[model samples]
Target: MAAFIIRRLLQSVLVLGFMSLLVFVGVYAIGNPVDILISPQADQADMARAIAALGLDQPLWQQYLIFLKQALSGDLGRSFAYSIPAIQLILERIPATLELALTATGIAVLLGIPLGLWAGLAPDSWPGKLIMTGSILGFSLPTFWVGLMLIMLFAVELGWLPSGGRGPTTELFGIPVSFLSWEGIRHLILPAVNLALFKLALIIRLARAGTREALLQDYVKFARAKGLSEARVVCVHVAKNIMIPIVTVIGLEFGSVIAFAVVTESIFAWPGMGKLLIDSINVLDRPVIVAYLMVIVSLFILINLAVDIIYSLLDPRVRIGEAKT
Candidate 1:
């Protein structure tokens, strides 16, 4: 386990480096932020001052070297748009993104699994057909459109929930989060649901497929012949076996939820890193954009590493395969 972890960590370091360089070069090619930052009426002296102040006067290589140096000591530079440390700004918003993503993922798993199990167990039944139909809508609908519909129904016409914003948050473990407060939860419901829909669909489909496959296996037949309770045969033998794969996918999808959340956050006006990242991109806030991308890349690496470790623990074959390699 130790060797595997160490090996993965080393690989993560290399991947992070390559991704950072790619991000930096791509962001730099998006045209100079100076053009957008500088005023049209500004004189040459003013332009020079701005350029020098931003260290844009230096060669690209030099600028990157400087950035690389600062990054080693945990400085990702300051946001040109906000005049705040990019990393600090990302840190401030991490809680909200994490909270939203987790909530969305939870809703997906909680609702999707049972629905999927039903559909798999009775694929031709009416209720199962209804559930599968809904899953299709979840997969087919665009996130922004769904978010708008949700807001219109829940907040506009019905007026039960707030249309946007994080609302009032109570601090939990020194981080102000909405899930702790009732009003906050009301505010959370729409966006979380909007974000969750696609994942929920995916989970439902995946779970259903897994369940059907598991049910066909000899163990399920054996459990049935042994006269075990139907619930035990389904839950223990079938459902239990499918859970490992479902969980592994869910774990990986959590990172995706965070990455693709920009549209939902924007539509809902939710204050999360995704929203922040959008704002940074609009202004070409290079530091913030770079920082956000790096942070996201790091998150994906960490999540993947965690999923690998957890999967190995749950399935001994994975560990054995690695040892053989």
Candidate 2:
């Protein structure tokens, strides 16, 4: 396990190094920030000062080298727009995004797995068909349109929930969270539900497929033949085997939820990293853009690493020593 982890860490470093180059170059090529950042009314002296201050005066390769050096020391530099360290800015918004992503994923797993198991256990039943139909619709619908419909129905028409915003939060271990208060939960529901639809649908399908496959296995039949209770047979024998793949998907998808919550955040006006990223992109805030991408890349790597470890533990066949090579 130690050698496996070491090998994976080495691979992750290489991936991050390559990705940093690609992300830096891509952001650089996306039109200069100076044109928008510096007013046309500014004098040459002012322009020169601004350019030099932003380090845009340096060559591209030199700028990247400097960024690489600063990044190594955990200094991702100041945002051209926010006038603050980009990493600090991103971290400030992380709690909101993390809360949102976790809530959404929780909804997916809690509801989806049971429904999927039921459907897989009895595909011809009315309730099973209904669940399957709902999953299909969840898969088919576009996120933006669903978000709009939800806002209109819940916030505008029914007045049951707040349309947007994170409402209120209290600190837990110095991190602000909405799930602590009832009012905060009311505010979280619409957007969290909106964000969860697609993921929930995916989990449902995966769980259903895995359950069906697990039911056909010899172990399941053996369990039944051994006079094990049906619930124990299904829940313990079947569910455990099914969860191996689902856990992996859920881990990776959690990272994606964090990275791509921009649409949901934008629609709901949620104060999260996704919204910050969109704002940064509008003015070509290169530091924030690059910093955000790098942070996301790091998160993906970390999540992947955690998932790999979990996968190995869950399934003994995934040989750690053999995979290290």
Predicted candidate 1: what Cα RMSD to the true structure? 1.6
Residue lDDT tens for model 2, 188-302: 9988999999999999999999999999999999999999999999999999888899999999999999999999999999999999999999999998999999999989999
Clashing residue pairs, candidate 2?
none
Residue-wise lDDT of candidate 1 within 87-171, one digit each (tens)? 9999999999999999999999999999999999999999989989999999999999999999999899999999999999999
Every model's Cα RMSD, please?
1.6, 1.9
TM-score of each: 0.97, 0.97
Model 2 C-alpha RMSD to native: 1.9
Q: Which pairs of residues have clashing backbones in candidate 1? A: none
